[model samples]
Target: MHDHRRLGRELGLFGTDPLIGAGLPYWLPEGAAVRHALEEYIRDTERRAGYRHVYSPVLGKRELYEISGHWAHYSEDMFPPMDVGGEQVVLRPSLCPHHAVIYRSRSHSYRELPLRMAELGGMYRAELSGVLGGLGRVRAIHLNDAHIFCTLEQAADEARAALDMIRGAYAALGIRPARLRLSLPGPGGKYVADAQKWRRSTALLREVLDNSGVPYEAVEGEAAFYGPKIDVQVADAAGRESTLSTVQIDFHQPERFDLHYIGADGAKHRPVMVHRSVIGSVERAVAHLIEVHGGAFPAWLSPTQLVVLPVSEAQLPDAEAFSRRCARAGLRAEVSGERSLGARVRAARLVPYQAVIGPKEAAAGRVALRLRDGRRLDALPADEVVARVEALVSARRAELWEAEGGES
Candidate 1:
């Protein structure tokens, strides 16, 4: 049950400035590095999965949300619209409506049955000040979001594909989903009053989950106002569950926006929209990782992967040169000779590996490698050390010491 806020401070990841605002965190360099790594990984994964990445505006005209029904249904969660150049505009609270507009911007045939548009976009929400915590609950969020527009016949397959992607991402992060939830609309019209559409969308999601061989629970009144969804609940290191990923079937927005595609029958047809987030919020995901790993991130994800420690002033040049070698080998490395060797080693615990350049090892063109867990490999050639770390990073190994032959 490590507190992410404390861990963030200890690791120099992120912090909030009251003068700026609450629930808004400023990412330090270390934090930004981790986020960059995550963004690149997700982008690569989405590209390989046939998703087209795009950037959309963070603010939209009032009429845009009106057309998408967000003005009526989710206005309370949105920031007040600002009068900009005589037109009312507000920060976007979600990316799906903008994506719908993107789909409607062009005419598509059945050949483009599944149009997957992905973006690591930012959104703003009006959350209560009392509820704001670290990255878990923030006014600003960066979502690993995407939307899929497809025909009714292709809806289930697309939904299944989204689920598969979610599972693969979780597996890579060493996270286990506690349960899958089918969130359906409840009574009293908290949702849209389209019973027929709701029933169809809910059934389609259930069918996809059942056929995919994934166990799930059905919970009413939890669906988004637009439609039902498959919500993934993941337990943190403390065993507290949080919803991190989702596959939502949106039937309302496409119809509200009059989005359409030409069918095989040569007629206009409404394409079903599936909204998804593989890791939910990038900020929150990093916080989760910090807490789960106790601020010692995996080698591939660590901001500072390697640190070169010079045992004495005479060894400073060797330490600096070794760091350069590591940098040339595509690893994040730096030399630290300002502090005592013991103090430097203690600070290097935040990193995945520390290479000690002492007089004996520097003379032999070698270094002593120290693992975060206090394991040591003495007198390894500098190139060999870089090669070993390069392999771990290339494989995206979750733990440096757990890589095969990594233990000394």
Candidate 2:
């Protein structure tokens, strides 16, 4: 079994420090490149799916979570409040409350019922030391969280659409869903004491699950304090499953925040809050990606997409020029001229493409492109090579080289 922690260290992706505290792994240069790529891809995906992105503060007034029920029901797992300018403020444990305030910022007409807001925001959890390990469990979380505010009539369809988006994202990331879980509230927890609301919310999620045509387990006592959720679970190499994506129906937050919209009849009506995540957290998502690909990310997601190695010192100028050309085309390319050709090639094995500029090939303004997949195409124009790589990356294709007679 492949352990992400091992691969993460071996690949120089991420690491922790004693001074920085556990569970807060700092991304290395290579890791940051991969993360930036993931962030850009998801932001573009969400924008196309009609989500309006927003930025909210990581800390909120103590009363904010209190009003959202996180302070009352989830304080034990939250960081303690600290005084800021003589007023108590707390690091937010979740982004729902801030998004709630944004939704209530102004009056909205029923025609704009479903206002989809998204943010790749940060939150903190007061996790126990023993439970913290690598990126899977972290005190700080950067969530791909979004909230949809719509009328009751539109909530179900909005939820179904979120599920579809989550599934599509998983496919693009090469992640396989282990199963779907319908998490329900159980007895003696901090669940809000509203049986009727619980039933209504639970029923709505149940219907959404049934119509989704995906088999899911209805597991009790595993829900959020506010409502039921549909968790898309993925298993690691060791066969341990965790929630990576989710769609939830939250009636309590809207009611608590007193969010409303002007209906067609010109009367104010309550709006339902639907919370969803495409990828649960940046840390966990990176962990899973590390394990899934064993550090050999797809071309687009690879940290260093192309590494140019000159066959000898004589070809250094051509190698540098080729690297610059690749960079101009938006490919991440670096030229390695310090070592022998064989050493440079082996050092860049993890990169998606390796370009070799020999004396003959360099003189011809061409390169011998060697794919990480063990395929090599010789004497191709440097511009043609750059264009093909840029195209492959922009399209986010799984394959390194485009489909053709020689490259494939």
Candidate 3:
């Protein structure tokens, strides 16, 4: 097992500075590139899935959470509210309340059967110092969050759509689904005291899961305070299961926030709210990827997908120029001309593809390609190299080198 903390340092992905406090990781340039790639991928995927992205504030008035019931039920996990000009405000613990406000800002209609609002929102939670670790457990979190406002009749269908999105994302990332947990409220005061609502929400989720033909285990008292949820648990390389994605059905929040849409009969009706996240938290997702792939990221997600190495100082210009061309063509490339050829090649191995610009290849208007897995391609034209790599990136292939003609 590759320790993510050590790999993170060696790869220059991220670091923790004591001055910045624990569980707050500052993304280095390399890590930021990975984060950016993941963010773009999720955004594009959600857009194609009919989700409208939005930006919400990181802090909200205390009264907002009060209305949403977080103040009473989840205050211990929240930071102490700041007294801002005689009003209590706290960093948002979740994006649900803010999104509820967004849906209420304007009148919606039945024509908009499913109003899907999404955001890569930041959130804060006051974790115990002893429990805080790397990106997996952090006080500052970048959540891949979204909320769906729909009619009661559309709730099950919307939940099914959310499940499809989760499955598609996991498949793309090469993650195998380990289990499905239908988390329900337990016999405790921690949950909203609405037995009727809980029964209805849990039944709906069970129906959705049953209709989808996916077996799941129902666990009591593990649900969000407002509702029941379906959690997609994936096993990491070490076979430890973690919940990476969730689709929750909330009936309490809509009633609390007075959220409504005009029905076809011309009367206002409460819209059922569905809370979901395809990749739960960006930081945690990257950390999971690091451990799952053992720091050898998929070609499309790697920070430095290609590194150009010059055999000698004489080939420096060609190396730099080729790297720039790759960058211009939307590939992450860099020139390694600082040390001996052998040393540079070793460093370049940290990346997926290494292109050697030597006198022989430069004269031929081509470069020698060496994959991370020790396969070599002799004197391929620069354009061909770029085209091959671009195809891999476009397809989001997991491996850079394939035994069968390097297609991946």
Candidate 4:
């Protein structure tokens, strides 16, 4: 198992302190840097997928939950209510209810059939003490949360578009889903006794998956109480699979909220709601990234992408100049621990990549790039190195690993 606590300390990422109370994470500078990068990627993807970004307040009236059925079903996970004037208010547990409120704010036409709204929402849920696990599970969690409002006829296309965005995101992280599982509620599961509704919704999802040629397993008894869902699973280092992302179709919420849009026939019709999380919970995704990369992030997402090691004081100027160039390219670069040439190189390897440039490389306007695993690529021009690093980060290409024996 990966020693997450040790790694977190070593990287100066996050920590739990008694003063902060239980189940709350204190993100240090390095942790915040990683989080910001992740949020930027998520924002970019959502924009590309046609989602309009909105900021919702952290607290909502208790009546909002009561109207959404969340107060009855999920009251335990919610923070206890506080008195706001004479009425009760509580922190938002999820973004869907808030998004639904936004949808109810406007009148819409068929032209605006597929309305996608998203938020990088910081939400709170009261968790039992036993459930807190570093960044994996916390009471304070940030989500790349979004809800898509679509007409019944446009549901399948919207779902596929969301899936495509998710795939693009995983591609950037060098992660791929080993399995696709489609969950449909059965008689004993979370589904309400609306047999015809469940059948129609499940069939539509299956048809979309079949048409896309995406192989998936039908998981009975795994659907959310609100609707059926599709989950993407990733294999960890130990070969255990965990859900990395999910797409849920919520048919019941729109009806419950009385959400409607004007149709081509000039009739008001209830819209379908789709909840998608390309990276699931940001906290869980960060923990998974640390494990999958073994704390050595790739060129793009590494907290400190490269450290410059100077041979001696005379070479410090060139090294500082080189680090600045990297910073100019939007890469995280630094220089520190000036010591013996060999010692500095060793310390540099402790990070993901160490760029050693002294009088020689600097005089030649080149840099010697070294990997953490003792591999070396030498004497590349600075511009070339920057381009190569950007490409690797953009592609999220995985490094080759040694085979245990030959492939079976």
The alpha-carbon lDDT assigned to residue 239 of candidate 4 equals: 66
Each model's lDDT comes to 0.88, 0.91, 0.88, 0.79
Scanning candidate 4 in windows of ten residues, the lowest lDDT window is 399-408
Off by over 4 Å in 1: 236-240, 401-408
Candidate 2 worst ten-residue window by lDDT: 399-408
Q: What value of lDDT does candidate 3 attain over all alpha carbons?
A: 0.88
Question: Runs in model 3 with CA error above 4 Å?
Answer: 235-240, 399-408
Candidate 3 lDDT over 106-127, as tens digits, reads 9899999699999999999999
Reference-based TM-score of each model: 0.94, 0.97, 0.95, 0.88
* Per-residue C-alpha lDDT of model 2 across residues 74-182, encoded as one tens digit per residue: 9999999999899999999999999999999998999986999999999999999998878888999999999999989889999999999988888788888889999
| Per-candidate RMSD, Å | 2.1, 1.5, 2.0, 4.5
As for TM-score, the candidate ahead, 3 or 4, is 3
**Which residue pairs does candidate 3 place in steric collision?**
none
Candidate 2 vs 4: which has more TM-score = 2
Indicate whether candidate 1 or candidate 4 has the larger TM-score.
Answer: 1
**1-408, model 4: which lDDT tens digit per residue?**
465556766778888898987778788887777777788778887887788999999899999988777787678889999997999999999989899989999899879869999998888999999967677768988888889999888888888887888888887776668899998776654345566677777877787778778899998777866678888887655566767787877787788889999988999999999888888777767777776666676555678877888777877888888789878877788986466878877666647667778778978988888877787876789887766665555554455122225321
Model 2, residue 395: what's the lDDT?
85
The true-versus-predicted C-alpha distance at residue 61 of model 1, in Å, is: 0.3
